[model samples]
Target chain A: MTATSPTARTGQVASAQPSARPGKRGDRTGAASRAPWLLLAPFLALFILTFVLPIFVAVGSSFTKVTRSGLFGEAGVKSEFAGFSNYAQALADGSFVASIGRMLLFGVVQVPVMIVLCTVLALMLESASAKWPGFFRAAYFLPYGVPGVIATILWSFLYVPGLSPLFDVAALVGLTPDFLGANTVLWSIANIVTWSYTGYNMLIIVAQLKAIPGELYEAAKVDGASTWRVALSIQLPLIRPALVLTTVFSIIGTLQLFAEAQVLKTVAPTIDSQYTPNLSAYTTAFAYNDYNVAAAQAVLIAVAAFVLSFAFLKFTNRKSS
Target chain B: MTATVTPTSTSASPARTSAAGTRRSGSKGRPSTIIVTAVLVVVALYFLIPVYWVVVAATKSTEDLFSTNGFWFAPTVALWDNLAQVLSYDNGIFIRWFLNSVLYAGIGALLATYFAAAGGYALAKYEFRGRNLVFGTILGGVLVPGTATALPLFLLFSQLGLANTYWSVLLPSLVSPFGLFLCRIYSQATVDTSLIEAARLDGAGELRIFHTIGLRVLTPALVTVFLFQLVGIWNNYFLPLVMLSDSGLYPITLGLNNWLSQVDRLPEFYELTTGGVLLSIIPLSIAMVVLQRFWRGGLTEGSVK
Candidate 1:
């Protein structure tokens, strides 16, 4: 990459050195040619402060325990190393474990449904004879603008029994729908997730679809291929990168489910404070006054997210290769 | 931006699409096209339904909010009344929250976009030592869940005496690995090295060249990164919820959620919550429609990398 860079390619060798080198991360170069370093400074500083430091702090704090001398801590608080105890405590809480299981189930069902919907939407909108793709695309994407809490608040109206026309119509047909029931609220949250993000994932796929060269489509038509054939044979395989990208994000998102479930908790009895792992860690730290345990739970959640994404990546990459 | 990349491409697609349209209509009958249109329409409705319900529900009075059907307007039109009540309800705190949101999201996304552009341009156009290390770190950042960073960040901010300040939220919103990734891809494909060299030879400094030449060609990337982070920060709840405890510092998301969490006790807030949700979404929904072209143009050009 360095060799192919334009300055290197043009052989704009520095007066004192080759390629001006712009130095390195810590070359302490003269003031003349520090453009790249200047450019990268702001992002690097904040990235380290907010991103790198947090992970280090969370991990470092997770290993230690804090004990107060008395009920009100009249004596000084003592701190000591406590390896793996916080993790054990986090796992021992059945609600915390249940939260992880719930998120896994949500992802297993919702992520695939959302990804498939996005792919289908992308393909259909980009199809040869598709009409009004622009209008339809905007309609699908408008929900992405609505914040998660707001989206749930709007959807909760439809989930409430007496307020919902959906339930009213169901009852008229000699049936009753319990959207906020303990067993059904999870799927209702699933419905909200699908509504909120399909457009976003679809947009990415659409962008990828647009990048597909017109020559391929023309050749498929030259071969007298049908629309379905072109979609299956060419479009599906071609958009795999976008599909994989959306799926990985969707999985991470499924793990970090907080605001939507929190908003739905107002109407649904099923949604507890620890209904999702992200919410669980939040409750642990703020409500239970257990920062170390919360940090451990957070690390576990991050591990779950990484594992899920890597597993999905391996599955997709292996299949393609 | 997406109307036609160069207008010449437009001539080819319609001809091809119409040809395909007629052939499919002939073989599979008109039902095929109708089916496609029907399915597209249904999906569009599914996405639009929630927004439409909000718009309708916002117009009714608090009493009508419950007695009326969830999907339609009730007998009385209380749109203005609801707005007045929500606006004046708590000494007009909602407006303060709205402005706070604008401050956090608008300024944060703009600075973040510029940083991404500059950082991305550096990564793409220059080769420095540890470049791979920087890029590799950012790649790992992409895989890390953003929320996990929030709690620890709050702890650190409090330690630094920066908690409850706007900087806590604004500072973190400024670094987006994904935006930097997109800008890098866009810059690599679009920025002309020959132009940069020529400008340099003419005695234009690096920053001047970047501003004049590099950023000119990087509009698609700038627009994409700006809007992406704008939506992200604007809709963000967890970070602000953790960082700021002051009501005055609350963004619309937090303020609205605060009201929502109280609706069970004060059922009258139902109207306020509905009105607030509708009002909050309007600005971005309009932007979504108006900027749809730039989004298409930006993402279409640079998504591969």
Candidate 2:
């Protein structure tokens, strides 16, 4: 991997020398001019087809409403331009707003806790005195390899009353807290998300930690700085980019919480079909066959995610720079 | 700043290396080290418990699953029985789902990686009009949560008569904005512009150059992108759930979820879901262990760039 870097530098120099000459005079440059477009064509085609077109369709559908024309609605439904009605309806939805608020609360509480845990774990692993870093790293990271659905399923087994060994243990202590209970189910889902992602975030932070030169540690040690002090002063400050990255990702993921909640809805009576924003949109579209409203909800969720993530990036960049 | 730090650090590094070594060996008796290790060990157990429970649960009979201790093995080992039952249940649908997941992830990642590599290489090595515009658009795609697209994609696909088909799931899975972004950065880091120029001078076509030299240099990054996309599509639930209503076409994630949702009514599906989950995870866990370097390298490279 390191070998590629120097070659890349030299390649920059080599390419720069030629591009300096007049572009119109060189036959080689003329042929290579169109190569970029040719190479980019396949990805561009797929990107527009999958990414751009869907958003266009979504936005278009979000502005329209389906109306029944014939008796018994058997003559087929016609789509008419509804202007902002779908968006209005979606915005007016109490459950939808509540779900979004729930997700926001989830992010506010969970993201910080997870980030701190990940940072602490990464620091522990990166410390010079730490032993068996490899074993612990893999052990922590193992959950990331497990699919979120499977991880949720595994945790749900622990959350359910009779099926849970944790419950049995709680029974032994005479304190069986209802994990999947309506009041506590959100935290249970939060636990699942944290378990699934904490290690992945830790790995990112640890990577950032590794890039910190060994000299920093030595310099700190020579200056009589302790391990904890070095970690606080050096490691934490340097890993700001990674911390920002993971926090933004967690925020976006928080709003898109569907699979765990959707799966848990069956086992937990407290979780409604519209327990999450994504789940609400999913059920509205598929279960109720209300595509326009679902499209509006999805667009709203996307906008919220975009704004939150962009704000985070802007905030972090301003501070870092 | 880094230049000044490097030389001073290097000159003092030899003594520091030995000092660090001694410190590491000598720190075993420290209370702080022991406490940190113990804390890590406890966290590791927290992560490992579910996996351990699943393995143990898969071995028990239905009677044992409910009656036996949730953490330990039952009187009789029924792992094979459970595996057989899971594989044979519902006309071998679990096996079908397993194969479907392999197909979706394997082929989807392959094509996605190729496109990302090609696109990234182009963006990095070639200067053109609208380059930054294209790059910016793709960067924007990275922020758009995928679940946000599922409902829209379903509407579009249904209109095109592609809904309830494999293409609906596979087509959308192929466009990974993150993979493309990673590849662009990786290509900039690894693929030499001069090498492409040289290959062009040898009368090789642009496509030929990319295939022969560019692909070779970008192999490690491509593998990283491939693995990321592979795991992503393998673990994906919402897209398939929204796109394909046909249970026959469900991936392992969706199919296992279906089985799990039925566990309350059927009650026999508990072992099957456990067995199916274990089966689904085996390949991913093996890949993670074996491809540890690429995974770490990809993530670090992505963040640093």
Candidate 3:
């Protein structure tokens, strides 16, 4: 199905080629060619200022080390090229590495659960027999409208024993689980992430499901396929792109888990300042004042994100092919 | 086959038409359907519970908040008093943060949407040199997680003496790579090249044609991009946390977090924080409910394409 779509698009482009020839010729002229660039100028300018320059700055700073001077190392500091020493130090830091590992474990566990839940919710909402699908869809997605910090605060209330109704119910049952404990905090963070994003991801999958040609379902129905059968064979297979997209997004989001952990740190004493890689980078820069090491860690995090996402895309593409 | 499989005609709900083909047909009143619906309802309740808790918790005074049931309202309501206290605390700083958030998200999204539309329109409708390169670079930007750049941005802004200022947050928020990508896909699907060619043949300048013709056709997409960016900027915490030091320039997220961190010292801030959080979410929730179609369209356009 994926293979045919590109060829079909190419066929359309081929048929449309004759008409586009004159336009292409006209576009070669100086003024005509300049128009596209002119329209793109504002976006590119901001993109460079915000995206490109910062990346270059971060990359450059990552290779340099900061040196302190004076009695308390407060009077003067110098920065000089250190030739990957900062990277070495960042990779050597056990706590930073542990944070990254924790994030990886978090993503591994949380992402699949979130994706499955999103898929199920999306499928249920799109099912014909579901009542008030619109209401459920909106209710499921409303959390995406709330900011992560606010969501964390709300969940923190539920985690705290004195404040949470969940605790009251748990206590009555003789089971008091400490959600914000050092061991359980990771899962608690995962819960918040899933709650915040499940709807957003579900929306994406539902969009893909909506895009499926009705004739395909019609044909499947004529074959006496059940709703569950059609969903597994047609909807799930066809929505692969959306699933992969959501997974890649979830992976990136997981690695950059900062806001929920940061906000919960106020209430959950077990949540250290360096709970996630992003948080560690943040603390390293602001608290330790080691901008170079922080930059190195940031660069490493970006590289890891790129590598993981690219690998996932490649693996999925290879499998599909 | 079409008559039998099309689900909209079978569903009793009026809203089902919008979601027509996505739904399964002939499944109403089935046992599996009932189970599915029940599970979905439970999931919906799980999602809404936290927001509901906050709403109920916000109405209680600090004394009543701890004493009363956690999920229900207090016997005597104090929502108005909590709002007053939240607004008046630290000389009405919550109101300032609210305005700052409005400024950041409102103007930032507007400008970002415009830039995305213009850029996306060019990429979609016009053929130019290095177009692929430009698009590729933007795609690369989309994958570079925004948090990874926050510290670097802070450093760069500090170098330029822009740190702790409104521009620090506003400048970064103005560039939305994901929005640009969405706009590109949307413009491709919606905008017509023949119209542009005709406009050019009639001696309409490129800028005028885009402003008058292209933007008019792209209003739906523009709204989609705008809302996406608005929510993103509104929900943003880390960018401002790293960039700004002044409370006056803080967005609602940072402001509320600051208030929350101080709750350990003065528990009175709990009611204020809850009130502040509830207030902060109202605008975005309204936007979500009203502009639901556009963002949904934006999401589908983004992921499907």
- Cα lDDT of model 3 by residue, B1-305, tens digit: 11111222222232322233334556566555666576666677788888899999999999988888887888899999999999998999999999999999999999999999899988988877689999999999999999999899999989999999999999998888888887788788878889988988887888899899989988877887898898899999999999988888999999999988998999999999999989988888877766777767766666544
lDDT of 2 by residue, B1-305 (tens): 11112222232222233333333345675655666666677788888888899999899888988887999899899999999999899899999998999999999999999998989888888887799999999999999999998888888888999999999999988887888788788788878888877877689987889899988988878888998899889889999998888999999989999999889798888989999988888788777767776777777766555
Q: Runs in model 1 with CA error above 4 Å?
A: A1-33, A72-74, B1-29
Predicted model 1 interface RMSD: 6.8
Q: What TM-score does candidate 2 get on C-alpha atoms?
A: 0.91
Model 2, C-alpha of B148: deviation from truth (Å): 0.7
Q: Counting only residues 3 or more apart in sequence or on different chains, how many pairs clash (N, Cα, C under 3 Å) in candidate 1? A: 0
Estimate TM-scores for all models. Answer: 0.91, 0.91, 0.91
Candidate order (DockQ) = 1, 3, 2
DockQ (0 to 1) for model 1? 0.40
Cα error of candidate 3 at position A58, Å: 0.6
lDDT of each residue in A108-207, candidate 1, tens digit only: 8888878877787777677645577789999989989989988998899888876666776677789887888888889889999888998998999998
Per prediction, the TM-score for chain B is: 0.90, 0.89, 0.88
Docking class of 1: acceptable
